[model samples]
Target: MQEALRLNKPVLAICRGMQILNVAMGGTLIQDILELWGGSIKHFREELPEHMPAHTVDLCGEKITEIMGKEKIDVNSFHHQAIDRLGTGLLCTGISPDKIIETVEAPGYFWVIGVQWHPELMFNYFEEQHNLFKSLVTKCLENMP
Candidate 1:
């Protein structure tokens, strides 16, 4: 992630990938979002259903909203840890109802976005989620030699 970021390469990190990106960029994680944020809604829910629209992530900034084509998106969550202190140059693109970091991006760079949800899992059931994959692939292809 650091190398890709240094080279301004196109990359999309998901869930724990986002956590790794944060740690690589001198940021921190909640460790256990469930235990730390137990007061909030059941973010670490178990056995509800696979690929169900779990929570709404309110997207911020014109870039993310434009890419997602909405101010908010329903995403399926599956991780216990999340970003706490944001990575350097990475902006908080979206957040959950309980204020968990749902999306992030490296501003002034190429496609270096990260999301806490599994858009790949949701892409089959929800057509809107496919845009995330499409966006990543499009960016990657654009940067290819």
Candidate 2:
């Protein structure tokens, strides 16, 4: 992440990748969800994987909302880990009702963005979700110097 940021490269981090970026940028994590939240609430079901539903997320009305053109988005939840302390130059742009950090961004810096859920997995099932990749491609193209 430091390398990418130093190079001014466009980045779209997903899941663990987002966590890595945050950690690299002097951020921290909750470590254990069950420990922090005080319960073994399964965020992802391994057996009935297909039972995943589109959950609502609150967009912080920043560049992310401008790019995606919406204040709310339906996304899939998978991981138990989440962003606790935001990184430098990073902004939390989306969250679940449970207050999980759903998305983050470094706006106006070559499309530096991240999402907690798996948009790639919902591509076939949701057009809006797939548009994220499409948007990233467009941003990458625009950022090319």
TM-score of each: 0.93, 0.87
- Considering only N, C-alpha and C atoms within 3 Å, which residue pairs clash in candidate 2? none
After superposing candidate 1 on the true structure, give the runs of residues whose Cα lies further than 4 Å from its correct spot. none
TM-score of 1: 0.93
lDDT of 1 at 115: 86
Q: Candidate 2 — which residues are off by over 4 angstroms?
A: 39-41, 48-51
Looking at model 2, residue 92 earns an lDDT score of: 91
Candidates' RMSD to native: 1.3, 2.2
User: In candidate 1, what are the lDDT values of residues 14-121, reduced to their tens digit?
Assistant: 888988988888899998887887757667656767588788999986666777888879888788888989877778989999999999888778777888988888
Which one is best on TM-score?
1
Per-residue lDDT of 65-102 in model 2, one digit per residue for the tens?
A: 77667888877767778889988878898987778788
